[model samples]
Target: MKSITRYLVINISIWALLAALSAGVILTSLFRTSAEDAFDGQLDMVLKMLVGELATQLFSSEELSRPGSLGQPRFELPLSGWYWTVSRSNKDELVFASLSLGGENLTVESQSEKQYTGGIGRYLMGKGPDGKRIRILEREISFGPDQSYYFRVTGNAAELDEQIRSFENRAWLLMVLFGVVLLTASLLLVRTALRPLTKLQRRVRDVAIGKSEAIVGSYPVEVDGLVEEANILISSNKETLERARTQLGNLAHALKTPLSVITNEVRSSDLQNADMLVQQVDVMRDQIQLYLDRARFAARHNTIGTVTKADPVLKKLTGVMSKIHPEKMVDYECSADSDICFRGEEQDLEEMIGNLVDNACKWASSRVVVSLTEGLEEAAVKRPQKKNANVRKWLSIIVEDDGPGISEGKIDEALKRGKRLDESKPGSGLGLSIVTEIANLYQGTFSLERASLGGLRAELVLPAIKEE
Candidate 1:
């Protein structure tokens, strides 16, 4: 499953980027459109006002050189394109000028003959000898009979265009900042909302590996029913498995005595084919018993899913071995915490550990060392103390002997059911096979390696059970 943090971050990033792009497009378009409309309206009013001013000169028939008359017209200071002039229609000359031009010649276009309505005009703007870009409006107004005059008005648009561009830049900056903040907030919201789900997932994993009895944390309403149902299923399955194993074990024990009596009677028979028949029946019975043992091992349970101390199990096995093989001395050693414990069925644990320790005693000349530690190997011995049954923390039980070890190539096949290196060696190869089955029951693992004592080592590691 994907991690929640990464999932939320990716979704939030995409949404934030899209939102920023959308806001930028919309805000820029609106501001530019609104500013253009406002400027266009102002341009129209300036055109009309300039036309009225020029009409006065044409109606009075004033001298072309007279100050504040037809020759020189006063205008508002800081004039942009708000300028006017009255000129003779025939000569195409300027009859009067305005301070809005500051004595500069006006190169107005004469498009009046083509079309004479409100339209765009290009002309120089400002009062300097040099001019800048501006839009001009031109129209013909009649002052009196045979006294028609040309009126032109213009305004500087450079500053207004700069202002609009500046506004656009600010808008984009604000959108980027908002997008970042929105993305951060969105990620946090996602993480907080999914926190319970994360916990549920972890609890489920613990149950799957037999580390937890059930989900223990609070859940949101959306998932509470699901959790309850899962807990019920886990409980039911464990109970059913245990019941099946117990019945299988009882059946195996019930048949063992009958099978042994038949084998003893067949062995004493004098008939030629009777010995072969007896051996065959004995083998068949052993196979049935091995499977029965496996079933019994699988059915056991860890009570309340609590951890059982590893040192105690190891010490108990060593003590039992001393009595079982009184001639051999079994040593118990531990390198892990005395508090170290694991989640496992008690019977299965004893079965697996018993097999390993018993085999070590059978083969060892004198000393058999057993160590129960919490780690995968000697190098990994030092680790954090926090225990979790379904995860990395491991409770390793290692049993080593100083007897001759099995050949390297046969180790893998040795764990197979009914397979033994030495048929003459007492007891069925079923011991190792039973150990393997028991290890699997609790989700534990086992390996046979060369021991430090130059013999065989059975290394078993199981997940540590978590405390309630």
Candidate 2:
């Protein structure tokens, strides 16, 4: 149930963290190798200088009791962790030592028996005097067949470690900053990349809420296919519903005439079962009409982009009502804002409003009033957290009459199918029931109360479409 953006961010963060960790480790290892190689190169240069100084001493015939300087001043400081020594290779006897050695010997443990040859030396890590770690380079030079000397130079390993540690700290800091910058850039890129999808989501929501008939917008190639598929689905659903409604209407029309014939035939006969047959045929006819009305209402329910102007439909219905019941001599008054509209099919509005007006004329003695208003209900405005909060603008149809109103306790029965308060009244008792069904299909409500004119007040509330 997680959003796409959140899922992408989580995955990207995990990968970025792992990439940072891997880069840090690799960089640390490379820096360590580079630092050790630099330290070893310094040791090699110092060892070569010492060997050359010893050759100079031998050529000048100087005594080997004291070590000669190799031009590095730190080698002269006692226990300064930089030292040089010369010894007999065969006996391991010290021939000369630097002052920094403090009269102690440097002992190196060799892992292999092979000696470095070809005028080159071997570098070793070993223990110095005072148990300090040191890097040593040892080389052997032969003055004659029986004379061989070992030249050894040592430097503190701690200095090399400190250099590597300092580089590690700065390198890791830079890598962390780089990772943060990359992740931030990635977040912005994701939002920008998915903006089309967000817009598409809004368009689809507009279709669901009856604001638009289809998804409409420009999209990236990656999402254009999805938009097309959604439009196709909407079209498919509408087509299927239309086909079902057509079939239901055809079936209703096909059955009505035959049923009417059966009822007429039974009424004309005098057989004992004629009455039973007539009653059964009449029930069948009512059921067919009821289901046909339901099929029509279902077709309108949830239909997108269906807007009906209320003023014209109401005005037309009032004119028809006067002609339909001229004997009653009922005076009709209708008032509505021209901009007030219903968010449903025109036929559905006509059906519901026509039934209410007809029912009012049937019961009214002299006067009937039909009014339309556009506003949010008191309960709807107070409880803004309701599911249909977007449908705040409601079109209210109020019909009132001055004839006798039904008792408040029997109002519920009036809405039920085939429930008639007086059998003397000329009706099938399905008028209010059909109105209620149609109102419910449009996600509206139908209610009855005491009219201001002393008859019944029939109020219908339906979602309204704004003029714009």
Candidate 3:
């Protein structure tokens, strides 16, 4: 399943990035517009001052010289890019100019021209004294009819362009910083908001692994209903299983009482084939016991939080088997990475392992070895999840004895429910079969193979529970 926290964070970051870029673009554009306006306003003011001073020179056609009270000292410097000139608009006659022009003329290009009527001048982009890109503002007025003059002022625009570029660089840097802070804050807020869900998930895992019986915590209002429903479901399932077990036990007892009476009556009688009747009664009893055990194991197979440590169980079983076969001397060995556990009912585990160990003891010459499989660190174990019932982990328990091993062809015959390969052994020939059945019920596997110790190897795999 996809994580909600991851989804929310990715979406928030994308939108924040887009907003930062958009804000940066808009901020720099407004700054550039204001810069252009200030530059143009200064040029317009200087043009007006020159036109007022040169009005007297227009009356008499004296060769033009620098006008007075221009106030800007840059006009005195050669090629300073601050200059004023007066010329005839209809003819190429230079009437007057500032010393800043250095005896060079300024010409405005007609293509990049704009006019502001009602006493405002015309503006254009053109070349100045040294071929530098410049902004020219010119005003034309007629002293008499047919005698008109143009007042021109030119300034280099490199400072204005540089100022705009510097502002854009600074603006983008600040926006990047702002975007980082926004994403970091959003991440922190998302993690904080989802902390309750994380706790709830851990609590639920604890229940599945038998660490807890019920979900308990002070949860948010959004999750209170879920917690209540989960607890109720767990309690109700336990109650239902308990009632079913009680009913099955009662039924078993009720039927067994009549069977016992019939068996005793037939054995006391002296009729023909009385022994055969008793033998049939014994078979019926065995069948009843087998099915009853199967029913009990099936009921507990899917129950939640039923974990059993294998070490204690193995210890107890090995000691009991030793006493059961005093001459065989059975021993238990645990080769797991740590204290591993079986993820099933304790009784089921006992039944499976007990049957294998007992069978080993019965067939061994003088020694029997029961071992828990090694390399448990590589094989993970977990509870059966609700959404995926087939997904499970396994741990192996093995029992081998140094006795006469069966050939590969007869191995299948030996696992049949009532097929005993050796009649001398005092058993019903159901131990191996019963172990196989129990392993199947727990969604596990059982196999018999040639033992390394020159005996039969009975390998039983069962669902396991281990910490991460």
Number of the top-ranking candidate, with lDDT as the measure: 2
Candidate 2 C-alpha error for residue 132, in Å: 3.2
Listed per model in order, the count of residue pairs whose N, CA or C atoms clash below 3 Å is 2, 0, 0
Clashes of 1: 2
lDDT of 2 by residue, 99-182 (tens): 889899886865324333336567777778888888887888877666688888888988888898999999899889978987
Rank candidates by lDDT, best first.
Answer: 2, 3, 1
Using TM-score as the yardstick, the better of models 2 and 3 is 3
- The alpha-carbon deviation from the true structure for residue 34 of candidate 1, after best TM-score superposition, in angstroms, is 1.3
Candidate 1 residue lDDT tens string, 1-468: 257678778878998999999999999999987886576566556656556555555457765342342232324443444455666665377766567766565554333222323643433333333456554555565656777666665555576678788998999999989998999889779889998988988887666555778988889999999989988877887788777866786887788888888888888888788879898888879778767766665555443444566667777877887898876665545344576766656666777889998888888876787877656775334433322344656778888898888877889998897787877667777888878777776666777878889889998877774333
Residue pairs clashing in model 3 are: none
CA lDDT of every candidate: 0.69, 0.83, 0.79
lDDT of 3 at 189: 96
TM-score of 3: 0.81
The local lDDT score (0 to 100) that residue 225 gets in candidate 2 is 95
Clashing pairs in 1: 81-154, 81-155
List pairs with backbone clashes in candidate 2.
none
Better of 1 and 2 by TM-score: 1
Higher-scoring candidate on lDDT, 1 or 3: 3
